[model samples]
Target: MIVLDYPYVSKFLVESVRDLGLPVLDTPQVRELAGGVPLDYIDEIEFSARLALGGKVYTNSENGLEHVLRCRCNEDLARQVDICKDKALFRETVANLHPDYRFLRVSHAGLSGLDLSDFPVPFVIKPARGFFSLGVHVVNDLADWPATLEAIETERAALNAEYPEAVVSGAEFILEQVIDGEEYAIDVYYDAEGNPVITNILHHHFLSAADVSDRLYYTSARIIETWLLPFTEYVRDVGRECGFNNFVTHIEVRVTPEGDILPIEANPLRFAGWCVADITNLAWDFNPYECYFKELRPDWDAILEANKGQAVVMVIGDLPPGTDRESIGSIDYQGFQSMFSNTLELRKIDYKAYPVFAFAFARMDEPELARLKLALAEDFCRFVKMK
Candidate 1:
């Protein structure tokens, strides 16, 4: 029997597992007494590194036995990719790999004397590796490049003085033409056998314009069949060539006006936060953890089967100016529910507050979702309390 520290496991994940009658071991005391779960002692980053190295682990915690499932093949692949604070490399990599794909070419602030108004509106500007929206600016003209570049430089200087380690000295900022399209995430999951199966596709909406972080919705199987499969194949080939197999990859993409799908960037990690949970509830009728356990699969066919013609609504805050989480009080969940009971699946009661919160998610009825979506938009109007 394996024992593990409970603290290392996610509470929501553990609870879901516990609800089932599966055999397991957990709790820090028991783990401490029994020797400890196989990998609980390692820090998260270290754990991720070790797992990437083809490590196989078995341990139990406050929840039960959790198999640190990973592909045994590509353990040392992490060492191959050069990690640096260079944004030029990012642009170069994309251009080199997919020359035909529409992309924004970026030049350094000092190097390029391009006009913003001369180009086009809604182009993106940021330091190769920028934080927040500090060094990021969006302008619609080539004429505005001078001012925007100035803004970028000022922010860059401030960041260098304040958080030197976060920015590489003499870092070059790049301005790229932003693509027009809906944003989505492709969640890559490797099965126990080492095959990369796209678990879910999600639509991402942002918490705020400044941050540019997004809320997500599970992609219907139909959407995947129509749009995602080809892209999936493309990435699969690329990832395999890059020696990335048996791990999760979050690829951000946009669908263009020409109906072309273009990948913006890819994260070599799982989508952090409740996003995994959100995708789980709407598409699978169970969240990611439950899918991990393969339990309570209410609609196994529907879950795995794509394009069952369903949709999920993600609610996010467009908070009024000067208001924050502490300022609001006595929020009414019931009142909110009365507005959109039909499609409501999960509500994001509070997501870190401030500029990016007050959101709800509704699972629109599959093959029958339109009416519910309308109901939600009409019925839901209660202000979420800040405090």
Candidate 2:
């Protein structure tokens, strides 16, 4: 059963749900979001029965998580969700796996008075329960502390107002050591038999060390070839440790230069937060949702061969800081697409309601690494107009 909840839902997911004939958990959001589109919807009672029978579930957004959690009849399912959602609990749950990793959870109020002299420096700090990198900041030095705290303080109240405490909160934050390595995001699920099956993996490309924005992520034959088994096995162990199965998860990790894989954070029951999971379909000709529903493992040998030396990139057209959304007249999507070597798909977003101009998918050859770099450095403001 699928739960369609707030923030955003992609057109591809809606079409996938209909084609697969999966039952959606009926709610007002279904009527509002799907409108007259045909769908199979199961109510709370029916959903509960499916859980009792070990039916697998998926959600398009974390905002819908509360509904799924509230109606689930299994205690283990709820525990899995809680452990994945709360960063503090997630760290503790996997503490033994990396006993030397440093992390501390502090309330929002305590941040101002906390002493940082003995605390870990060059760490990433963000809301304990965060989404979309709202309060995330990387401290490169002790001198950046006051500015970081001030930024969080200035943005804290708005964070609470903009989202449900369930989806995102400003009550507490987690400080942890920064793992230095190329980062990747995985869209994987534990099958009914409790084995992890990975569908797609994206290499999250950043402009610099201090960059935390979801600006650029790309998947290629090379990315899958490099990290597939290592990530699958790592996540499988984490799932086994947490007693998880019959679910979908989007995980991020940083691999050290020594070839060490450090678990960053896992988002349970969803993929890549919005419908960015559709990049799996765009890149590899398979829907991530379909993999979870049908319990199918992708034939990577064939897929990588077909996509050898090719890269499909997901770019988030993030709005520049302090841009007045109220004065935004339009986004020049055409001008934006011109930056890439070969454009695959471009999705224009409703900036008044959300934080981005668009989500784009592009295909590039190895020689186009320079093209990806150009796109990354492209001033999004050049493509946006003010009223």
- Go through the candidates in order and give the C-alpha RMSD of each one to the true structure: 8.0, 1.4
Clashing pairs in 2: none
lDDT (tens digit, per residue) of candidate 2 on 64-165: 888867866877778888988999889989888899899999998899898888877799998989888888999989899999999998898888665688
Candidate 1 lDDT: 0.47
Write model 1 residue lDDT over 74-144, tens digit each, in one string: 33433212111234444455564556543344555453555443444566766665432335566665667
Predicted structure 1, TM vs. truth = 0.61
Q: Which candidate is the best by TM-score?
A: 2
TM-score for each candidate, following the candidate numbering: 0.61, 0.96
Q: After superposition, how far is residue 358 of candidate 1 from its true place, in Å?
A: 3.6
Ten residues in sequence with the least summed lDDT for candidate 2: 370-379
